[model samples]
Target chain A: MNPDLLPLALGINRVILYSGYVLLAGTFTFWSLVWPQGRKDRHLLILSIAGIALTTIATVAGPMIDIWIAGMTWAEVFSPISAAALFVRLAALAAAAFFLVDIVNYPIASWRRALPLTIVVAIAATMVASSNAVGGPWEVVKLVATMGHVIATAAWLGGLVALAAVLIPRQYLAELDKVIPRFSIIAATSVVVLLVTGTLHALAIAGGFQELVTSDYGIVFFIKVAIFGAMLLMGNHGRKYANGVALRAAAAARASKEAKINHDKLTKGGPGMHSLAVAMGAELAIAFGILLTTSLLVFVAPH
Target chain B: MSRPQYSLPNLRRFLGACVVTAFLVTAVAAYYGTPEPLPASVDTTSDAAAATGGPADQAPATVTIEPEPTAAGVELPSEGPGVSEPGLLLIAAPLPDGTWDVSEQVMLAKPTTSLTLAPADISRAGSQFGFARPEATSVQVSVGEQPVVIPEARVIEQVSADIPSTTRFEISYRLDGATVTTVPSTARRGIGAIMPVTSGLDPDLPVVVMVVGETVLSLSCPELSLSERNCGTAAGDEAMILAEPLPFGAAVVAAQIDIPRL
Candidate 1:
């Protein structure tokens, strides 16, 4: 294999693995907390399964790529650095397994679900420890900041996916009424965290404004920013639509005779629901592009 | 559902708008941020080996020095901003240890340069390899009809590598018509190759680019075990390298051929 190809392939693997873990943890958290019938929802199970499958692929492929790039035998993967990576992958696997067990044994009680969620948080923490931000000066400080960034990203993106796939399609104004507004708050906080951590990372690498444009790394970084901008626009539209739905639902709930009529109309493919769905879907697509660029950014030389 | 006096929907809209505003403002601030002034010249002649504060008693490599490549003009695609000639750009960064971390990137000149080193290079140090080449301060090259100028190139951290297992050490480039191939520096290990190239002339003027380096440390052990290994020197030590005026040469089978404008 071409030596450079190994790193690029490994970068792709990371993107896939991270997406899986984030979606799994984020979707499950929202399902358990907000949705009244979340536990019984098949969509939640499917989402968890998909996340687990992707994480598993990454866990297996990541180490192999290391071995290939190093031109070392399989036995060398037990080295300290590889071991750390393996640790994160294993935690992600365990979290996925827990989700499977929870699904297999239906009605396992609410408290028991916390096990998987706890494991999910552990996965996030381990990921942060193994990232570029950590293993450097002020390790603890950087790790904490990176961890916050990772968790917030997982929650925001995963929640959007879950909302679009499960809740938006159902279009119950009452459910939309509860989930949309609450999700908006969570997303707002997550975006703030993402923006802060992302900026810090950029400043650390670029060092100055000149480096950002002069270097190849800087050029790719700008591309990421552009994709992020698109996501923000879509997210704004989605938020507005959600807000409109909530207001209409509230007004309809207060009316005695027209309550059922208004609720049926809103629940059955209303303009607000369609708009929110499209906006959320577009935002998710743009976010995926951002993630791919991030993988490339790490591999490029940051002058 | 219970309704509060204040509208929750409005609150959601306000928060969402706030996040978007924050995102846009931060991006704008960064893109248009003031750039620092560029240094007039980088001190390329400095003997990095002596300055590294390594063990003073250690002896340097004893290799016969061949004639360096002659200074000659080569036609590049253009002299536009951010343009690089299609060839091997050998960069040597001095590490904390006396040795130098010599890396080569197969650069294809494009309208917009988005350059990245072969992952094989970053993995040289294993997982801890942050891929940060802080030592590659500048590029000194002579383009046709233009004064030799060292333009700034950015390097980002890629994936990690196992120091001992990373055997690819030499950097070589070969230009074949429209295709430019970079030989896996690892194939040569410590020994480098100097080859002559035709400088787009009728008689084919030979331009010699010499790439030679000595590995200060290499880990070789049974079964990839970290602890039980045979590394002559401490890990993370760099390979000592000397590249005379850069020139294209014969490439190895494993070398990658990158077509420009693709």
Candidate 2:
């Protein structure tokens, strides 16, 4: 908050932000291995861990270098090294965004599993983006909303995959019973959160409606909205699939019981009963694409 | 069949490390980088109240100006070598309206040259300033410990602030006659209201007024915004003359003109 170290503080802030992203990625990376039957490739785990460390280092470098550049009592302190550090960190944030799509095991049917990762990526991008405008503290708000949007999209898509591909393919009236209702509540809540937080982050970054459509930043935003709208449509249909409401009553009743058993098994870390992994994977892949664009958005000037 | 769940030692450890690191960094910045307040020795311009009862009517600041024999008799061309030798460094010209300074204070240890300007003929005010000079007058002298590499040598209209350039009444170093150069003292602005520093000098000695050009004047309200200006009690302003011509042997070495209050 001190003005004297304003440059350094900004630099540090960037570092702190990157570290948060790595930690986020690390949690999921760890969880992927932590679960039973998950792949235990030591090499992959090392790569993930190393990515996190690089991200963390990039975040820290932002501030320390800024401080060094702005600091020192004598006038002879300026040099090329500090400028190089800042450029490197910015590039790191962009790289971290790309790795979000590249890193990790995208589990098939559990929308719940994808939710946290999505939110983390969103928040990280938001932090990197907002760093351009509202620097000098108070930028945390944008990060929060961005993270929320991320979590929502992940959960929405992941859940859709769970319903259509996993639960539906089982073709057992039994599996639909548990998957539909549970996913219903999750999708509903996630959608609401997504709408609210997305609106807030959008308004803050775009600096209001005029800029939203006029600047290059605005065009990217418009594209993002189009993708979001399409996803929403996919999700509404997804909800119906999860609830079995459109199915014959007999099938719905039988599906209800199957869903309950499936829930119990999933909670206990047992193998999945539904065959919805492909659907969820498709949803995730689409979401990942959106996320990369979002990463690019973070770097674009709001004008 | 399972042990009771408990606290996350890892989470606690992370938080603890963050706190410790934050404290350490803050402490380091505070210790080494924090700047102390500068003392008031040099920056008294902000405190006008302490500088004066306004401009002093009490004569001018005095200073002891001893011209080395090498510089003596160089004021008027009629009194020294013909208008063709070195600056003679013998002209003991004192600066006008200098900040309170000391020769031993490590500030005035500089090589010097002098020039004079006035109506070339007494019948005019600010007109007819040309005079004849032998081609070799006013040679450059290296003054400081730093070796000065002369990049260009010529009498040009543009005057450099860093290099010593002066225009005042200068007599020939070898001949006993005066000759004014095409160089006119081009000093701009008036005496800054800031109390010029004065040095100790014997009033009995002559004070030489070495001007940059003919006459210099600074009016308060450079943009004409202020109603008031720093001038002497002469109706609208305070009249500040650099040197009152002294009797033949006596010279007025220096004077501190009160700047007009803008």
Candidate 3:
């Protein structure tokens, strides 16, 4: 492999891996935190499976590429660190798949729903620990900051994707009043955590503002942050539309005591819901842009 | 006017377009954002053989050096505070027992907290040891005054250390006992030392400096035979080896030094 192309290849692999993590983690966050009563939708399941496949590919391919770059033999491809990381990731994926099957088949209690979320949090920590940044100074602080960043990213971006899965298909139009508010709260909290942890990570890795602007890593980091800002704006717009739909739904419920009102027509086919869908779709698109810039950041040297 | 219906198919199409756009933008960013590829190592074995119209194993032509014998023996070239061309500086002293005491100094343009040094390949043309490969043992590395510790078995033929903040460091190792032999089909005998012209150095100028305390009977760079400047200048006691300008990978500096006795 051409050493020059290694960074590009690694970045692409990270995109696939990160996408999988966000989708899977987001779906679980939606099920557990946003809409506990909502059953597993087929589209969400498909999205989760896709995430598993992408993560598996990245987990397996990452080590192979590292070994090849080091000019090591094939037998040495699975070094101790690589092997441990791969095993933990694969085990987490398998457990997630099992939990998804159970959620889809059985009507489990709301408390048991946190299993997948816990698993994903473990996966997030594994990712941070296995990164090249582990052996550096302030190791614990960096790991905690990075893990928090990844989890918050999964909650926000992944939850947005899960929201799209349900909202676009009008799968649970009646529950929109409850679902949208809950998701808004989770996303708001996530955005706050994301900003805090992201700043800490940037300060720790990039060293200072000068390095962030001058280095390749800094440039890509800036781009990711810019895309994230765009996502936040779009998210705010979607929340407003969601609030409009929720207010109208509450009013319809109050008026329905006197006369029959078509709840589906009021919530599903309304302009408010349409605007929310468009805004969310745009947010998801921008989220992918953030993921791409993040993947590039992995290969770029910070200072 | 009716609001646009966001059917499942429509949503999928919109997302597909977004994904394509994201990929295009990311690809462009990556193309410009990533570091440039390293230069490729120049393989000069075939070219050297073809130039002389001799067998591949034929000994490379040698340049005999008769330095003005000073009373204090050969003085190694002085490396000033600032390095003009940052690369490896190798100084070898021929011991009475037919072994060379080698000390390699790494000069990098950028300051690094850690450094990894790989053993040189001794099988190349002009190396004194034809078949016997010598392992670097009792390797000691220090950045100025602080001695860096080397782990026992992380890599093969390589030693890495988390060194102090410095751009210049020295690695000294003993070549226990290498089987000394002459180049094939030639009576010339010398010590051949190959060092790397590390990346981030001026490829157009001399990147490696080899100094031998004993008198230099013959000097030649087998790898750079095809270039216009096949070899660099040999002063009183040191030889400067020129490196071919390669864009990406580190180039090899193969120097064959002939002393009075091997």
B133-216, model 2: which lDDT tens digit per residue? 112113232334322222232212222223343222222111101111110010111121111011122223232222221111
Q: Tens-digit lDDT track for model 3 on B1-262?
A: 8657896645655654565455445434533543221111112222221111112233333322233333333445466212444556666554543455667666677788867766555444332233334456566777899887765522236565677888788777665334232211111223444453122334443344443543332233444443332343334433232323321133343333333332
**Candidate number with greatest DockQ:** 1
Question: lDDT (0-100) at residue A245 of candidate 1?
Answer: 76
Model 3, residue B76: C-alpha shift (Å)? 11
Highest lDDT scorer: 3
> How far does residue A282 in candidate 1 sit from its true spot (Å)?
1.0
- On residues A185-204, what C-alpha lDDT tens digit does candidate 1 reach at each position? 88888889988877666655
Q: Residue by residue across A112-165, what tens digits does model 2's lDDT show?
A: 345334434533453434233232223576667766665555455434432343
TM for candidate 1 is: 0.57
Order the candidate numbers by TM-score, best to worst.
1, 3, 2
Clashing pairs in 3: B38-B248, B38-B249, B39-B247, B39-B248, B39-B249, B40-B249
Assess candidate 2 and give its TM-score to the true structure: 0.32
Q: DockQ for each candidate? A: 0.03, 0.01, 0.03
Ranking by lDDT: 3, 1, 2
- Report the candidate with higher lDDT, 2 versus 3: 3
True contacts kept of each: 0.00, 0.00, 0.00
Residue B188 lDDT in candidate 3? 21
- The residue-by-residue lDDT of candidate 1 on B138-170, one tens digit each, is 322223233233233212223122222211122
Where does the lowest 10-residue lDDT sum fall in candidate 3 chain A? Answer: A70-79
